[model samples]
Target: MTSAPPHQSILDKPFVLDLFAGPGGLDVAGHRLGIPSLGLEWDRSACLTRYAAGLDTLHADVSAIRRESFESLPPEINVLAGGPPCQTYSVAGTGTGREALEEVKKFIERLMAGDSDEEIDKELRKLSDPRTALVLEPLRYAIQATRSPNRGHRPYDVIVLEQVPAVEALWVRYAEVLQKVGLPDGTRYEVVVDVLATETYGVPQTRSRAVLIARREGLGTPSLPEPTHRAYEAKEWNRRNGDSAAPVAQPTLCDASVPGPSPAADDDLEHWTSMGDALAEPVGTQHRGRRTPFLVRSNYGSSGIPGRRGVRTDRQPATTVTGRISRFVVFEHLDDDIVYEGARFSMNEAGMLQSFPPDYPWSGTAKAQQVGNAVPPLFGAHLLSAALGLPAPAPEVMREPWIPATEEQRAKLRSHGCGTADDCTARCPRPEDQTPPRSTSRPRRNTASRQ
Candidate 1:
């Protein structure tokens, strides 16, 4: 795996802190973009993934980190970036659960203090006394020891947070807290965008998310990058700033036809081929065989099948990549005889769709956990590079050691017939015992077909 450059003028580059750094997707992207980043994660396997990605990783909980550590590090931290655990705000969560809300509050309060000692005083004031929150004593030392009173208190210049669109409103609180920490009002930040990818950038799959950009020194609130591919178009939502917008290019499952002069292209049809069962339907006469009628998968379904359709595939990007395994579907390639034609995303393929490099090293057994936890590196690269004024790199270029399929994962893929053209039976939680009858014996070839 490629590692950070030799220690030379690290001060010239932006220094970033990545909290809850799962598999280091964001940090990897930032590093590729020439930003120097450090990742903090609690999971050991996650830390390994980050290490494989060429980042300076610390295996520790973000809440456990002290301010003294920051004071000891270089003074030029241009960005404080992280997406804290989303459990509190996640749809599956109980809506700002007490623990999550407390963490949020504590995160803000720590930033306000810029160190541990001040944090203690703040806690004392908030609670009856500092002793009441004694369990937080270590954090107090970390904060106090790291604070730089001589440098004047100030938050990082830019903060980039990613989360589900449904819960983005919760972040206004973070913005509010940052502003209260002496940054100029209004100039402090903006939750500039909340759009669905399927409606805007044309990924074959549909996903939605909310991206928030907050800046310290009155830099323009970050705007969504224009789509480069002719495949998808900019959707003119009623809430959009303008009434009329141009059609953006749509990206296929492989190549995202971006709008720039140099649009990136790829023809890896793995996802298309994998989900063929869900997207394709038979034509012609009745009961050809035990073929199931293709069904569209919905993100909200319990069966974990792709079900929504009739939405334009060429006019917009895909939705946010969710962590839900049951909702995302992949097509399966099939050859006659035993029956074939549909498959779901292999854990690795799912990771790729999320914009992790093809070889992103994933840690742990829960494939869903690894894929869902990754930050879309492409998105992260663009956001962090822009924030730090550095040249951005594409997500694919960042390579790592642990990113390739593990032995066990390889066995899973082999079991699923990843390499062969044979029919593979996938795990479908449906109760239907009888397969859908095949209406036709031959496969019809159409260019406009959901390729």
Candidate 2:
């Protein structure tokens, strides 16, 4: 898919500095849209992956790194984008939104009080949860950049940030502060905040993220990008009720790697790509002679946590691709028999689900961690498009007449049950004799807890 030539705007588009640049998702988006970018990451694994992918990167902690250290920084930085580490404010995390929100408020209040940096530092040190306070670092950089005389009169044109939805209140609070006080240059920042579903941006996953875009007064107000694809949950609710109103669903795991889509794939109606398509490898028929391209037996169950109950191709997008993606089980169906082959989706598949290049240079021991933590490049593209005011649209969902794809299709995609998830729950017995259970019950029944 070709993009329009880079838009000629007020600012001479230079490199965007991506803080917390895990595995270059935003950088990939920037590079594709013709905007150069530099990533600042401290993790050894992420840094190695960035350099191996040949993407520009700086291996340093964003808290300590200053823009002046980069001799290559353009006269004007076009964009400042970053997603601060969000473990402290995630659902899977300790559920510390309230505590973090309070801490963030204190920081804002201290800043408003004109408390000295030493005082702010002392206050931050008082928090038992340190990561909670790290969110304020972006504001520090923004304030400093706006006030710096290094770039003559040009202040940073745009600032973008992302975090888990639980942190929306905190971000909105920061936005309030930035809005109330203009930059040192007397230019106020126009702020737009929203929570976006990654699937809507064509990432092949249901990951939802809260985004905040703030631009200093002058370059005009910025708005969040419009949803390009219908969210799967939204489509399912509509389909269940037979409320069919021209559905434009997000590309499913199936569409992510469907090397070649039929030219007439979406002629009459838009169809959501299925799990089978995303897992189909070019070395064989898209489904390896399976009756349909929608059934999959995954190691995970469909019930509790996502990816635990295996995912079926036609159901919903694969559960949020998390750091522990290895827990998923891959099943192979041969003719009339279903075989538990103990296969897992390749790292390439994980990358595709996250919307990275198929051949992205992957390094480091925590490869799965990098993949899980990244913002999908496709989603990042839409965000960049909004920042620069460009049009980034999702592709048409491949239309298929096979309405209500088979029950087996849904079963394979559905989480839990159906013998797809083997040894899934930790409560499943492990005999000292190493003998298989003689009862022959469904391998997916024993559920205690996931490790």
lDDT (CA) per prediction: 0.44, 0.61
Give a tens-digit lDDT track for model 2, residues 362-408.
Answer: 67778988998998887888887787766673432111111222444
The most accurate candidate by lDDT is 2
Task: Enumerate clash totals for all models, in the order shown.
Answer: 65, 19
lDDT of 1 by residue, 216-327 (tens): 4354444444332233323432123221121212212221111212223663212211122212232122112213322222254233333332211211223334666535
TM-score for each predicted model, relative to the true structure:
0.55, 0.72
User: What TM-score does structure 2 among the candidates reach?
Assistant: 0.72
Q: By TM-score, how accurate is candidate 1?
A: 0.55
Worst 10 residues of 1 by lDDT: 251-260
